[model samples]
Target chain A: MNFSYPEFLVKVSENCIKCRRCIKECSFGVFSWDGEKIKINHEKCVACHRCAACCPASAITILKYPVSFKENHLWTEEILRDIKKQADTGGKILTGCGNDKPYPVLWDKMLIDACQVTNPSIDPLREPMELRTYLGKKPEKLEFWHDKSGEIKLTTVMEPQIKLETPVIFAGMSYGAVSLNVHLILARAAKELGTIMNTGEGGLPQELLPYKDHIVVQIASGRFGVNLEYLNSCAAIEIKIGQGAKPGIGGHLPGEKVTEEISRTRMIPAGTDAISPAPHHDIYSIEDLRQLIYAIKEATRYRKPVGVKIAAVHNVAAIASGVVRAGADIITIDGFRGGTGASPKVIRDHAGLPIEIALARVDEQLRKEGIRHLASIVASGGIRSSADVLKAIALGADAVAIGTAALIALGCHLCQKCYTGLCAWGITTQKPELTRRLNVEEGALRVTNLVKAWNLEIKEILGALGINSIESLRGNRERLRGIDLDEVYLDVLGIKPAGR
Target chain B: MKIDARGMHYRELNERIHDAVLKGIKEIDIVNVLGQRYIGTGIGEKVTINVYGTPGSDLGAFMDGPVINVFGSCQDVIGNTMNNGKIVVHKDAGNVVGLSMRGGKIFIKGSVGYRTGIHIKAYKDQCPVIVIGGKAGDFLGEYMAGGILVVLGIFGREKDPIVGRFIATGMHGGTIYIRGSINKSHVAHDVSIEEIDENDLSALKNIIQEFCDAFGITDPNSILSHQFLKLRPKSHRPYGQMYAY
Candidate 1:
């Protein structure tokens, strides 16, 4: 009576050996051994490529299922499949990862400007390129006074700032959402790169305490595992207002997934559900948000920077302005295509604005209000490459946080089934047998390599533009030009159209 | 150490408290404390803070270990996300008291506003307890996952119910004890009401004894004379079946 169809067609070639290694490697139980040869259940194959990579004989060939229904554009195959699933289960369709819709990726529609004849591009190999950036509030003006001992001294107080070797940070990924091995890898990579990794609303585990200096602990509506010790141990704090993947909604980590380790970290019962409310009940107004911000500052003794993260919704500029005026040292804007552990398909695919437009509008609004220096902006969601990072900076972001990219670096094949808690590559699962597949040291090295490579690519881009410092490119919209984009987008991005 | 907080800004008052706590000063008496927010905040030491006047919102927020005794009424969010400590307010308080508090004990001598003791959770040995001496407003324990909440309704107005409407909405864990009968319309569907059992009576007795000790009440048995009703979540996972996956 099942009406669902297999998304992938997995075929084992004639080169198959009776090794049976694929059985242990496949976390989704897609392959089985019949005592003579290996049997494949193509229906269960998520196409994570874990078994394919581990197959010694190189026999597995996975392809998209090429059967179709009546060729009606209105009722597409994907829509029909979804309808069948709903009809069978009588449940709403749930999904993981970012939006898979055919929305325009604004980063691809923008081109970077480079120097040519008059201002020749400098070679990155020979010239010094400064990629070191700081994320925090900057003073409006510098004031200095001589001390009584005849020494020049600064009179204005300086706010706390987080230093980044490369303007890239690992976005918030909770330990419960991903594996502990993934958190370990992210922590190690952040340390090696001199950057930060955010502990998304889930509490920090004791094992990750060594990298506390390079970690940003998040405080969301749930207030999970948030205590004085948790606050004082981290380098910075982030008040998570909303994430782009599921804007205007909350998160629910089911009771079945709350293992002992996760329970200890989140400070909840071992088998109880951890529910995060959609909005912070205490924060009903901007003034209430300010109260919580100052409360955190007060608890930390004003020693650490506090950032407020919000999804890129309409009127994001005004919201960002209020957040800055509410005494946040940093602002993080998550675009519509942000990744998530689990979100309703309806909310994930159809909610929030793109980071490009939101970043530009927020930056311009903050600058127009003469309060741009009050807080730094960190753009997140759908930053794929070093080019995207550079382009995000030019679009008015102080830095960019990478979530999905970092997960990919740690061996996520993007099967979009992370909510099932059965990640084959050991990146997102809590099962002991699956989590063991991801080695901490090896995963850390891979992520570190990715970050280092991206750093070089960014330096090369900077040199091509005749800019030596990354800070020089921040909010420098003149260096960007739109291609095949409408006037409204171009106007909001504050960039000129090509051939203008 | 006795600090006079007259005409002092909240930042200055807090800084003074921090400086004193760092200097190993215990038992601070902050007098004339008119609307000073976040008093005793960030103080992890085993000191005592006694405030005389009306304090502002978020008193003892994120305070790990300390004892704060307020002589007058306080604003909203007192003991917000507090880890471990004791806060004894002699007068009435505002909304959202003891919000998201993981561990500690808050005893309000008089009534409180709406949403008091919301989202108070307990893990292992750390259970937060909030005891309201008088009636509470609407949504008394909404989204409460764990911990203990008791409303005595000792000083409530005549014919005004002990708590307002929509009590314990979205609550999945924890126990709520009210001194008198509850209005059926005021309770949420997710909670179940029952008569107190032997174990519940013992637990409530110990909590009421502590509440009596804090307010210097003469007869704890007299307060326990009224029949108490117990409220607990019918199911630990109220929304467990609501999700599709």
Candidate 2:
């Protein structure tokens, strides 16, 4: 289909003084002074309604495109119902993809059962349930024999390793993309929570070096700020193949955000635009990927695990299998619903596949190949409550990474205004004043609370299935039942219909 | 010590290098080196190593303090994560060279691969340098942090630009001195490109002259004859105030 710009326009009335108030308030550059009144560029707008909310004159109105019979047919009552549901929850809107609200959230159709009869729910406080998981390749065989000194020596291929106290991990958000304070909070929270936070393709900050043990340093196509010390310091090294929000595209940190501190942290010259190309120029084939994987293994001396994170696409299962064979200890699949600091609205909406089907297919493929244990799978994109976490595990995910959810816990309203970088909530912006809005203490607490709640829900789900551990539920499709899924989904998930 | 690595597999080469380093062999030379990937990767201490022939991808990747001197052409990701020490390559280097270096210096006597010095940065005292004696491929110094990158295009008498399209695309803090003319349209809005004056040339002359001195060039004069281009960031505020509540 031919791409066309949205027909609707948003404008602030003549009442606006053009004092650049909206400019200062917005994180996304939606409204700009056109030498007259503040002009609203609909193309740049994420429909976050942040500008409308912050407008003092209340003169701004976002007009929707006039719908002819053809356009009106595209609208459904279900879409309106979903929007209302999000509004009814708390007047807080939840959305997936780059502000486009038409996509289906498969998680809503899937439900989790609670323990009542035959199985009893375990109190997480009283009974200890392990969420910890080890990510790495396991040796198939070991040849052991007693040496001349009477000590047993084993000849086994050394495999890399990374230990996680919980299945949840903080995904890659670079120091340059966000703020130093945000990285600090994530690092501190990850350390305290016994999880790991990723240093997105941007280089690791010096402040984050202290928490290196809990960091997953990323090396993307741009290869920003990566070095031996940065690689060695992290518990895991993630090769960022692509991001869900904007797949098949590279990243560009506008020259405006390349501050001195960020520049120093990222090792780029300050004030210069940081552009990450769409693809790793050198990595053309799976063999090249394998070379990089083994290269990292050789660099770290097989001490730390290596992860390859790619956006969920049409051929994700096949791609994941290649990654496994390429020697990745873990594969992180990001769904189309994943968040990004800034991405072209077009790419964000239509590029990648949904996480639900992607996870199931990848799991089924790997299990069939009998190489499922070769690497752990972590799914991200549109993960909301503890039930979603449980469903994901049952669908064959070892863990999940939450970006927008974590930001919400840290006071992000999901206004989808991250592109402009004026995040009033302070979670995404580099502005010092706006950044203070998100108190690190409270942010950490909220994240901890979210994880704790999810942990409890996980235990509850396990109890209902009569499973004692998370590993038991992983890839255990028999415990799940799809409510109104299609035959293809039912077959792929290997689940029966309700009451069947 | 001499090690002949002809026809040796990547794994075997890695094992031999590991064993040699472990044995405390500080200065060793390898002959007929062919496609031995990940050579001297992640070594902590400094070692004076020499390679006679081509080394494969990720050579000296994540190296801590090892000084690797390559006598011939090298493949992709040379000095991938090199922190300290140096990698002096006598021949052309391949793609993604010095991917995410925080420290150390990479001196190439010949042209380099694509995206060379992409996201290269520096800490307090650890500044990384990728000095290419010949022309560099695309995206040279893409997201450079706080290091000095000098691309001295010394391919005979021709006066071609040292870097290709999108050079210093996202450069923020460091200095990149390309010793030739750059297409101004290719420069990003965030960067300010200016002609290198005597002051700037003087600042980098020592390094440029030192590079020429190593490569057996008699004149650093012709190298400085051409005008140099410098790219720097325009603003400290990465993203303007767009969505502040």
Candidate 3:
């Protein structure tokens, strides 16, 4: 296949020094020196803007194409035209954000019919609408009795103790992959929002140690910076078995970005390439995953909930069932369109199943197995709006994690420039100036605003549905309806066609 | 001090080691510890640990400043990412040995598995070195940006001088020296190979002699009798002018 670079803005500047820094820095070989001046091959560029950032005299500038053509159309006419063209070509639908297709967003399609005639829609101004969610296993059998001292002794002491005021969470973004400022922003946002943000497999930064209660630490294959203390310093622990973008493959952080600080944080040698091995050396089977889960549980003394995170794949329902059987408190599934710091392009575009199908299947399978309530499900990978959240919960997820969406709230344009390590928005880079662009205070406020908006929207939906609490919406498949879907999709989603 | 961990698992051995260290034990003697994985994984601080038997994969992975001296054979990923520490292994180790190691000295008294010293780098005063007493497995020093890897094939008795393919693949910097003839076809297209002259030989001899001294090899004379081949990346300007408009 012939390869063509994505279109980018080219501004010709006379201040070219021909230093060849762009040539040296680009991993994709996007720039070349033509003896007298540096030349950029636009076709090869992924629009990462590393060259523009590295240019000493600021001779290079990359301008992204405007995504919005008109205000009311939702998507630009060009994007709509492109979507139709893809459909005409019999090609798979490809999009960046959480399910950007014209499919009737179930959250938007199903109007909550408020009972203005019979039941009163409780005023949120005076009455409380509880958004608080406890994500862990609930006891199957409860035995309450009095001890010899006449004190009530509970049969089980809730296996894990992670509490969230809001059902929303910020997903994993490691320190080395993202800047410390970004992590701090996410942590502070979680703390302020009464939620949690995961420390994506790269280990927790020392600066974010104080917000330990708001953090969800991860243990991956590399185990680069994991320790007993690191494990204990989190509200929850996630075992990153696979990522949505590149499910089967591992990760590689180039030596150039592995600076002294990143090195120290990751507990690896500075300036050496950090390679996360393809498979967990210790985990070969579901039984082995259980051993690791129990080991971590034993290590943490059951203080924090243990979550198994996997990419949403074809066999996700079966896999999630296995995870539930392994005694995991929660299971997080990331769909195909998930974000990544660095992953092979082939893997990013090809691997994993969609989040919608995976969520529905896993929920159905768990409910059928009579263990649906044994573990809570958290769906991630391209969750963009409150509508998606409602649809996710309706599909059987207790909550959802938002990584790319959170970054967008903090000024990311979804430029897919994270792998380049020169993200202009400061969400994905460690460079001081670029990182400074993302003010942690302002970023936290943006995140808080986003989640706050979503929470209000959830309340509005609930109020319309004549429900006061989010628990009523959980696994309420009766509220969802499928549109323009085939027999297989209908059967898989267990949804009837619209108007039926 | 003598602990036989022949059939003991990684968790059990790690627990025992943790307990011993907590009890203020300065030195540990581990015996018959066959296939026990992650022997000293993520242990921060200095301690003298001696292993009398074979250890499993990632024997000293993510180890910080601890002297791990193994008196027997070890498996894959020995001394992986070990920063500021010393690992002296008396027997051969398995695949991808010393992968991405940054700051440390790994002196193997025997041969190593494939991709030995791959992606090994250096920063400032911290330069990692891996000295192999025997021949290395394939893809030795692959993608190595910094540091040095010295493979002293004590004698060329092993079949297929370097076992594996694509030696020094993607290597942009760093040096790899082997004391035996490497088939020209096996050398990666990206790497430049040259015979080590007297000056290079002397530097290699010093490192090999250190390995000999640590492992009780009385003579470095026979080790020096073989010719040395050095591999370096052909281009600091790799990827060529692919980006030129």
Candidate 4:
């Protein structure tokens, strides 16, 4: 019944000093004492490098297993493992974080263009590059009127806008999924970075109400903690239609994670499972979605912009346009590689399409219809670094949301065991003992440092393109070139093929 | 503050209502509120809204802390996702009553349309309760996860069924109490019907009295003459093993 096997082999180097630091620093309980020698438990190792990173004597060496099974492309080892796992647990294979299997990462296929001899590259160290962007609907046309007092005034109606010092915003992660300290760290980091962090379906906690302006509250099918105050307290509201990790499925946070604070924040009874329905019972169709969107607008008195987050399905272009026409000020598309606290492995590993093509399709569809100004498009899911961010922007995303990267900044090794409720790093678990591992002050600094570094790299890329502002690079697909891509992909991506 | 909503559009009427509420208007009397969708929605104040004519669907959806009093009936989806508020309908209401309601109380004087209190949820101290005075149509309290729903059948006792087919279908949590008896074929598979206990009746009395008082009932005991039936979900995680995680 034991489907689990060691994926890595624990190798002890000849330089072993017997300091036993590995025994102390290994959080996965991989090292133990057996009589005279320290015994290594290969079954417990998740290859997180905690012991290796902390080893002062350089005595610990971990190596991946040499061919767990005969590598058959048709019947891959993952498929066999999944089958075995199902047989062992007799339960659905639950996974966390993003899709870890090898798939086509479109960002690596497409390249960011820099100014060469034809154009002089601006030095980012000395020159100024603006990354500030406003996310919301923009007026298609402006009109002015003169009153009887002889004073002229601009009479154009404006959509509520969200101002971001940088194009990146932290994706919505519920309080129950992560610890309260993690939420505080994210809120403080976002405030310091002059950006926003979304409070997922869970409402804003009482202590985090002071950071309301930097938070974007969400309303999903479950309508968890979605009250007038919860909606009005945030800078914006996101109606979660779907997510990248599990596009068609709903979310079920187990009762074990619903502790006291989580219960209060989500406004549910403690030790009760929170089940988010797959679809909004009210939103039967696109028009139904429009009603909810306008309902939120009316509820907020039109003070905050409303965004709709959807997965990158096959019909993203049409779906994006529908969302825009339905009065959404922002459209967030989460690609197939998005992360989650818990999702069925079947959908996470094989569900939605890559975001690069989806973003290009949506942007082109909107621009071709001459209604691109109606909403800002945000790309998310698998944004790893500034290079990925730049690639996403060039493909037509106005901004990006990062979830897995933010978790990694707080020391997540991406072991993909997030559903187990035993994260030693304290990033995913809600248990007090495990959550206490993260120091809020240090975690906030790490998140801040990550954002700052990414921002600096973004500015450098924009400067190298001779573009002074990030806006100039948006939807400029011509500035990008595709490597080893066919004509169909190039046309779909709206980018020129290499050696054109 | 009193306003005539005879010819006003729903958006315009809602705007004026929001403006008045923002200006600290404690009470508002809206006359001729015909088909104005989402009345008093998003109004986050301790104000009272009195409606004269037929109001629209979603009358206090996502409402924070306002008391809505309707002199006439509501169309559909009343108290949809209502957070903490009171919606008192002096007459009968339409379909999907209290749909996904999280908290607060909804009181109706007469019969309701189909799918009353569907997905009515509750958490912690914020438990939503809906009291329908008369008979209800099909799928009453369908998919209800938390909170309480009571169909008094105050008027339709002899003429029709107290509640219609597929009652409490897909319900995982919460309790639904009908003033009279129910048939086994009309209920959902996951839910079970049982005799109302002393504690359940005691808890339901407070909610019933409030509903009766809203419609100016002389005696609450007369309505409690019939034995009550309670329907609750047998399993909390009914679909727990449907999908592979």
Candidate 5:
């Protein structure tokens, strides 16, 4: 029962007021007053800076533990600590919000091309640059009609589309994983930014019913809170096959977090674990997926577009092709390093591929098979900056979804303790006391500003490339060049070498 | 609206039904409805569909508002992912019935196959209900999230038993009422059996009367005399410790 392996060191300065404010503000029990003087428990500190930020005396400083395990390849500090923690507590190794391991990040190695003297780059401050994107299936060919009197008739039917003001959307995060206030903030931001935020498997809370048009409800294997009214209330429905954080694995939201509010929204009993089976029992094959797709289509009367979201596994190209062929109008691919409320460390660190490679391969395969226009591809998982968004579009993505970035805008330091349900930030936890830390109206304004700033940056990039619209940049791999990538990566990305 | 679905394809039949519904018809009767899959799939309308013969699988998948009455037996997935609706069968039913049904009611006159009413759920005011008059195969009401499932041993022989083993496996939510006793070996790990009480009996009787009226079962009073037992999940988080341990 004594498996305390805190990773932070707390230092109290001489300027301490002895007011014990740190003891009161620290949610993780890192600071305490033993009836006399305030004491810091280094073992309990997650370094979330809740106490440090709240302290009025400016007396507390926090740092990582200045200890080493010889730094050997066979015995890294993380490996040693993880083994010790499990051996002592006999608990599953839990982590939050994507892979934090030091893996090779390809986005840092790719560069965008700008126009030279041959083609003058337009000034974004004066020139008009469009960032709008439409997501849905486009027909392969258009039909033409002419009048009998030799006058051409202008007419064509268009399928439903998700028109995004900027090619950025808030990714799906279940209500169980985050507080209701977080959903509201993300919803408000999506509404203001002219994008969408997914109601990840948790179903839409009734309070946010007014923001239904900006919400994308999800249908995972668990079928939580899925009903006729809930399905009809969203802009679209996403069939969640897998997530990058834990591909091919199931999900279990602990019973302790399922309060009355979460229980009502998820439509499950309070204090019961909400478990999602790894796969949909009925959909064992692509044909079965097609059946469910059409079933939803039939249910909605073909009004809203239906989408499929999958993790970027090694063979994602072929899987995406099968998904589109199965009648999905939009495809969402989550790469490794995607965020999660809770996931096993082993799976989060080692399961899936990068979004860049997966996006390139899927687009190339879809284009090669003459089915590129069948569905719109939305890339997700670890899209950090506006530059990454532009690079994803160049690699052939209609849009991108951001999860951890949005949380950062909402005051998350990524201490990576979301699974513990004791978040110092109010974004992830369901506890009433902790969730009160967020001011949703202000948080929503911050998120809206963040996205708007990113949109302006995107327009700047487009203007620098002499491109006036985002559609012209879509799948234009010629504008991107690989720097550190070898021949195979460059070939798979279908881009030239940087020097070339 | 009437359709002679003899040897007609399911697509064409569905199209005709869709057109008829769009045309504002409130009732449709289909004759010779044999082995046609997805009969009322994805139909979101308040209407009545009367089927003369046995229909195929997925009778009302993702159905929102409608009533489907089958004069004969039905097949698998009678209400797969159905939201709000009602489906009535005069005789037995097939496998995997009511998979992930959020809200609705299903009544069958006779026995049913395996995995019936798996993952039936409820949200807010919408609670799904499924009632069977006779025996059932194994895994009945497995993984039911929130809803009501009832099985009556009216048509089964004394030795047949009401349902096969492993009933209510992984059932985290909901209640199952059964006439006659179930052996401890037949029950799932997470389920617990309890003696039926007054409120339970009243609810059971109400659903039984509805099922009797739908299936033309005479003397519905006979079902009240049978010893009814209730099965519910022992814990909402049955596997909470499995992952950590």
Candidate 6:
């Protein structure tokens, strides 16, 4: 007996010309063309709307299934559905994407300040607004001296920094989780935007080697495809300690998804589960992390900056500080709202801290320790729009990483069914027919447009705030205020109330 | 080139090695190398390095292509994530030897500490091989995905068991060969242990012959006379059934 209810109601309107396009367009197999007319099994609809959008007559309609259980606040339809699913399968309920629970979104509760007639706003249209940002360790102080020839030379040795035309970068999304076309799009967009795209755990394919200058290769616990060439062929190295979606848990990419190409790229067998353990078995302590970090530095001959990425947990500040002291040039803090291709639903919704509080506390703690300049902080997870990026920078991030938002720009409807390997948008699936639908050039253009629009909006907001440089806004919490937020959150965020 | 790293820091010693390699030095020897870490790290050249004294942790880490001959013992993580190279250790080594090594061959003349050969994997043709002349500590070959691991247990430690408990735990790929028998209770549940057949014996013979030649042992046939038990993961996907999907 099936105890599941349809989440969406699909209807074929009277305007249907019976083109049979819906049956072919829907990768989820929601619609079927009978001998007479088109019929829909609403249970299979993920609400991707590819058919509705592609229809010439616009005959298809998709609506949320107008059904409800008993009026119980504690046990909502989502809770009951999950319970029923577990009861039926006796397996852990898995989900994709970020936390969907209605926890407080601190970004919405925080407001940015604008200069009102006192410090006159700068017109970004005509003025030179600086958005060029560099990510890496900075020396505590700079010293310069005039040579005998009367030319000033820098005395302090500067560390390697990753220059970003804009402070926003594409987050790490692996190849097996998404298709190669998606990676191509990200790499192309990153090159055009002058920002790096992370190769999340999955190894960089041979074709993407041309974009090596704009790629940050990730080394996860699985150690998949991590070799000398892979390590050296990147702008920077990111040792992924944990992910925000599934903190303290390992990742298991099933054998079914491990195609021959994926196997070659990851350097694993063609049909084996790529299991990334919870922790790097050898890295048991902070000292061990230091050893690994220094080892990578030694391997790269100190050319590229090495970073450590950890989930934004309760003690994220301390952990980030340890990461910096352990010789990391960058620290990437991923919050609970970070997206994943697939993860256990229990951990996805319940584990890790929000990026807002995590970034603020980490910035505050590192500043107090007087080693904030030792490494650049990249705050990720749940950055929605340009306003969120600005707020993140003001709260203390040197830059921000966007994953879900970037996917949305590439036609992701956020149905959260990426685990099924049946993405109608062709963004997260590897099936040949589905993956071919995502034209790499079009996807790259969309991502490039999104980043450009966000960058322009950021400049507009900076002009209104009377700041011409993005660096001047970083860690400038005085330019921000908490709106209807608790005193504890305000204190942690290092901001006052809205009226103040 | 000869480097006397008596009191030199790991960084300086490694930098010297890097410089020597860059200078196209084919062969270099370091005498009195007392605990200098990351020796020959990331050196992709086909160079040979001979170490007189004990090297420090993470020796030959991420080394693409190089040969390291160690006269004395080594510290922990001797070949941490080593890519392609040959590391021949004369005596004992510390824990976590060959951790996550994708491609390489590590030949130890004597015993090794705990968690040796943990998480070592193999690519298409680049299969990593680790041969222990003596015994291995606990958790041997834990989480091994691909590659071959052989524990000879021939260096005067044959009275006790060859390997410690929880052998090949969570191992999904790879093959483990241990000379003599192992207590079945010590192995993981998903692994299968069986006596070597003709083909297995032939491959094991080649690996043993190489291990003996590395240490200049006279009797390769003596080690071959003993029965070898082969350990392999029962299924390629160990956690295939644990997931809901």
List the DockQ of the predictions in order. 0.71, 0.26, 0.07, 0.52, 0.42, 0.71
lDDT string for model 3 (A83-136, tens) is 554545543332332322343333343332345767766666666787888898
Q: What is the C-alpha local distance difference test score of each model?
A: 0.92, 0.77, 0.76, 0.87, 0.88, 0.92
The DockQ score of candidate 3 comes to 0.07
Pick the winner on TM-score between candidates 4 and 6. Answer: 6
Interface RMSD of each: 1.3, 7.7, 8.7, 2.4, 2.7, 1.3
Give the number of the best model, judged by DockQ.
6
Better of 1 and 2 by lDDT: 1
Two-chain DockQ for model 1: 0.71
Q: Fnat of the models, one by one?
A: 0.63, 0.42, 0.01, 0.49, 0.37, 0.65
Cα lDDT tens digits for candidate 6, A1-500: 77879889998899999999889899999989779999889989989888988888999889989886787999889899888878877888888999999999999999999988889998899999999999999999999999999999999999989999999998999999999999999999999999999999988899899999999999998888888899989999999999899988989888999999999889888888898988997788888899899899999989999999999999999998899999999999999999999999999999999999999999999999999999999999999999999999999999999999999998888888898899988888989999998999999999999999999999999999999999999999999999999899899999999998
Regions of candidate 1 where Cα sits further than 4 Å from its true position:
A146-152
- Where is model 6 more than 4 Å wrong at Cα? B156-160
lDDT per residue (tens digit) for residues B58-117 in model 1: 999989899999999999999998989999999999999999999989999999999998
TM-score of every candidate's chain A: 0.98, 0.81, 0.81, 0.93, 0.97, 0.99
Candidate 3 chain A: 10-residue stretch with minimal lDDT: A92-101
- State the lDDT of candidate 3 residue by residue for B161-244, as single tens digits: 754577877676678887777788888897888988787877777887888888888888878787778888876434322211
Indicate the residue-level lDDT of A463 in model 4: 84
Where is model 4 more than 4 Å wrong at Cα?
A: A1-4, A11-40, A55-58, A65-67, A144-155, B113-115, B135-139, B154-170, B181-188, B239-245
Better of 1 and 4 by TM-score: 1
TM-score of each: 0.98, 0.77, 0.73, 0.93, 0.91, 0.98
Give the distance in Å from residue A204's predicted Cα in candidate 1 to where it truly belongs: 0.9
